[model samples]
Target: MATDSLPSAFTLFESIQPGPVYRIPSLLYLNSHQVFLAFAEKRTSSSDVDAKILVLRRGKFQDGSVEWDETVELSTAVKSGYRSMNPCPVYERLKQVVYLFFNCVEDGVNECSQVLWGRNAARLCYVTSQDAGLTWGQVTDLTESVIGEQVQHWGTFSVSPGHGIQRACGTLIVPAYAYIIRYRCCLIPPGFFTKPRTFYLYSEDGGERWSVGEPLSRCGTGESEMAEIAVSYGNRVLYCNARAVAGPLSCRRPSRVEAVSLEPGRFEIVHPARQLPESDSGCQGSVLSFSCPASDQFSWLLYTHPVGSGKDRWWRHCRNRTNLAVYLNRRPLEQRHWEGPWVVQSGPSGYSDLAYLDQASTFACLHECGDRQPNERIDFRLFSIDDVLRNIEQRGRGVATSLKHRQ
Candidate 1:
């Protein structure tokens, strides 16, 4: 952890004193408009099944500060008798269209029941905005057209709860996951005979046509996000980081799962990321890649998640969701080279999404964090690349000094 404290967080969404609560934050930055669109699930309570509406707040960056507008409900983004959740926004640069993708789950139905029973009650949907979120078009349901019969086999599925990516070649990629039913147990509290795997939805001709990619070969990975970065001169690949779901099928240690796609849809390599720790039962984190400050030919990856504080092996249990940290990987292809959990928030924190402002050389993190519990509020923080590098260097020296004393 960094010795220096981070700047105070700017609260964007909070739980209304007693009633309605907000959760599942997704952040999108439009380079051309110089605007940011922050999305969240407006629920009657903190429970996932209570999600009722999809809400958004627009923030315009100017004069070194973000001026956010009042929250607006995307009425068209929902379906009758269903709850909207997991707000994922993707921008089509050529069309100047921003597509907000989310899942509409059947009302009163929770994920556990759906998975255990092998019944899917969620729909894949999205709405678009042409004028930088000033207005949105009608909701488009693609569950039948794209997913088709395949969805029936899925116990339940969802799109990335954060921002999606657009490759340099004009391909749009949305990270997603599904719990495929393996069997059914007739006993009470029926066994969850299912396997969770990460996959993606992609579009080649802007947002005109979409296709589902093959699910990752590895199991027990879910709620993922992707970033397209240059690995070499004129060469780029898609980097993915996902929540490591704990189960009999998962890895022995709790850690984030990572993979890379040589092209657009298929993940060529999958492995457990030992360097990044995942909260027990897993929590959705965010990853963003940006050009190295020293050279545009190379890129670096930034990740944000809650870092366990206690020395006990079981420290990542629910109540201990504290010390939100941002890690950097200079060599994106090498999972072992990750560095610096820069401890941005030293208290309870949860889901996070990252965005880079090229003009400012700054990174913005829209995250779930609070003084007592992580779900109490969603806050934002802006820090520079230099800030991360300096803190990481300090942490490296501290570790080296400790090693010398032990020897």
Candidate 2:
């Protein structure tokens, strides 16, 4: 572990309208010479809130210096209707194109989750850029075929997946989950029972086309999200999941985080998963890429959010708090457990959209802060993996030394 503190990178807040509103699942891409970030932004108005994509670029962030580029809007009224959110971008090196995927909903009322409601709701569309972020190709619909027959009735349906990665074999593996509302009474809206199932889509020929693969896990009664790790120990592919189980109607279930190998695409109960040790009310968990350092045999870092608590029915006030947990592979994962939900960034401005880059030497985290005020903006920060690892090691050593002294 390095004794010095991790350096903070440059942060930028997009300038939208009355309220700077955005959604989760923003995309970050690195194109040899520059870095590109695409996120959805919504501006409230008298009639409806207009939504568009805000693109930002910079050469690098060392020495607190940056050649910040102007923000660009990717959506138009004629093409995108009035609502758009959850922009995910993937850089296709072979094709020399960057593909930006997002969900388009009608008006401002339907969230990606509202696809469960019988409404002309969310669908996945994408735009391509040949010259970095300077220009974009035609906006094309990508979800129609993948979700064709599954989304027939309006009741409610959503297949908003998280970060996507290209496999070593040049296959694009997109981790997604489908949530459908099943039953509802007068007091509670129907289609509120979220049945989340994990699945993947692959693109054999670059990003030109994709094939829907088998469901990663059985359709469980809960809200679930999936993430994929490209390289693990022994070069194995691993899949991570965070499931929000529905507790009794009077109370909510505690969310749990778990992982499994991609060969089987099933979650094995390796550890006793639990929500972060804060107020379970407004907490959501995400499993960032996992890595095992060359020096250590059993050390891995799991980046996630440690949102403390919330009161609103939907956890509207839930803020994103960056957290990392260190695990020791002393025994098999199914036998060993997790330790320390260490705080990385804790505040109203928590880090979201986390990605591991530069061979796990650097980590990039993007998050939005502030209330829905004009000042609300998205921030991108890069941290040294060494610094994070050192913190975890020091904590581990402290615990070990204490145990030895006591014994």
Candidate 3:
């Protein structure tokens, strides 16, 4: 199928001239309510320090179309002198409550300063809504109670900028990462070296209490999302896909890092997924697990991100944050079995969040894409599994024909 022939995308949030830009999309779909909640950071400009507040829009899905309501600022989900960022929403099934998790950073403090000085300024917090986002409760600060003294040992930390997942076993998993200080030198100005690693904030009992799981052993991993996948014979495992923050001297190249955890507090890091490429300097992506469209007993994985090769080797002019694509994998545990990067958006694109609409066998992507800059506006697109399969098959055949001519 041709990219232009697909359904047209809807603009959920657009940036105006002299103010209030939108970025960092977080999308969640509630099956019971047949509704979609889209969240994003409303910033004064494109810079991170200019982030002001969180905004939300509720969409009602029916008859193959969505009616999105007006966008509203989450005024109550903020602190006195802090800016809210990284909206991570997870639904609790039994109570049918939605927990909107985000990081509240001090007004002027940026993440680079936090990593250098080994001082943490970001606070882990959330708010709850019983009516699927009609109204929200007061903000609940979880940094002090959950992170505790450990906050001093590291730099900055934050939750997933997208939606979290609730396992079939009733465990709520919120993907997160922290910059841990590895070396400190006592001098005129305190010096510290830190590296990013991924972990989870989980609640086993209906969102009453939460605990921090152990960080992944590998370094240079950050800004992640999680999904619960059922391996062979109905054994559930947690799968994480994170942004790889590779440095000049680092051994690993820039790519999306994958890991699996059988239980909480322990993660087995898999090799970087070569098939699913990352943009240069790394960009956040989303992963979602759903039952195969054909089979009920097994699950498949769908990941959405930019299609750049994570370097200047391939596309010289546009090396990063371009060509938003979605890759499909039938074998969730394997690293090299990914197929079909069905290009959802062919131009400038940035961070994206994916949600499965089971009623129509479609996947929805809320992403940042624009003509010049990737973060200029936020848009949403819907495509079915059949669409992806058809595109992948065509691309494979074209590649084979090209190789044959070269031989």
Candidate 4:
């Protein structure tokens, strides 16, 4: 399926959804049908509570290029005036089903107020589709059942705005985060939000049923994503990449948190995790595990983040959202062992999602990028695996050399 021609970037969405800003882009590749689905939250502004719609774009690969169909904007009819957000699509190859996970919060209720008032404003919901993105089922609210007794005490939480992992042994896990409101106090004004953490829900039998898993030990964990890489026969490693959002006063570092697991539901935070040498804007990034034929290896990890060079210009680089590079992790289990971060986009680029097409050795990136600013539009770019490797070889010292090694 390799082609000599590279696919031109295509605009999936702009400021046409009644406002002038779009955020949180997610991309998923469906090997079952050769379809790529892009998900995002449509908003009038950057406010978390201002999100209005959950938008999706579906397309199939033809002649080594993308052929996108019509956009499918969705709004689940909830009982209250809640806005849908964080459209995460997970494809189950065993059952051939696509489960779309999202959250909804009351229209006027923002995230901070929800935690400060000791309230749980967000609801975990999902919808299913059999024929890729052609049609979808009704929204199935899982807050009460999945979160169960903790819904009242647990503060508002939401799924990672990207793909989930279905392990090689048929376990489906969706990464999520929540602010622990039970620890909030009237005098403290939601002290628990200073240390948000990432957790996950797992389903053993496809997606028919689900249950919450143990939260990662690292605090300040924000949006998260997970992928399974098999290390040996009948044994696999679960790698989780998360955004660690820490306030200025908090001592918890805001570097990307990486965790590994041998069991199904438990994750242990690996210290000295591989930190992306990118700007410290606390932006959401994506990670994928794919087969690299040239290496004769088990699996390789691909990560995306905003890469910058200078210390004084960190804020400027973070603001411009330029140089979104892709890093490769050849050694999966080693702590902070990463290499070859080749810059894929030299211009304005921000929050991105990656999906590797195994048949073509090509990676599809759906990211927020523009001519001068990052959020002007969400564009899709395709890169061959060989191109990235070549960039790393020619550059000699890989981009991973610039990564900050924190203790």
Model 3 Cα displacement at 84 (Å)? 0.5
lDDT of 1: 0.88
Model 3 regions more than 4 Å off:
1-4, 188-192, 250-253, 309-311, 314-319
TM-score of each: 0.96, 0.74, 0.95, 0.89
RMSD of 1: 1.9
lDDT minimum window of 10 residues, candidate 4 = 398-407
Ranking by lDDT: 1, 3, 4, 2
Q: For candidate 1, write residues 1-407 as lDDT tens digits.
A: 34465856789999976887889999999999999999998988889989999999999998768999999999899899999999999999999999899999999999988887788999999999999998999999999999999987788999979999899999999889999766666774222568889999999999999999988888889999999889889999998898886664543557899998886679999998999877668889999999998899989999988886745365336457777888999999976999977888877788999999988888899999878888889998888888899988888788799999999
Clashing pairs in 4: none
Q: What is the C-alpha lDDT profile of model 4 across 1-407, one tens digit per residue? A: 11123336888988553564777898888887999988887788866777888888888897898888876676552325888888788878887898888888888898777766667778899888889877888889998887988766666788888888788778888888877653655577664544567888889999988988877887777788888886665567888988865456544434677888777778865543545643355777889998757643478888887764333354454454566777788777776767655777667677899998888889999988777777778989998878777765644443345453431
Alpha-carbon deviation at 276 in model 1, angstroms? 0.5
Return whichever of 1 and 3 wins on lDDT: 1
Model 1: colliding residue pairs: none
C-alpha lDDT of all candidate models, in order? 0.88, 0.50, 0.87, 0.76
Q: Which candidate order results from sorting by TM-score in descending order?
A: 1, 3, 4, 2
How many residue pairs clash in model 2? 12
What would you estimate as the lDDT of candidate 3?
A: 0.87
With candidate 2 superimposed using the best TM-score fit, by how many Å does residue 154's alpha carbon deviate from the native? 7.1
Candidate with the larger TM-score of 1 and 2: 1
Model 4, residue 86: distance off in Å is 0.7
Model 4 CA deviation exceeding 4 Å by range? 1-7, 16-20, 76-80, 182-186, 192-194, 250-253, 278-281, 294-297, 309-320, 398-407
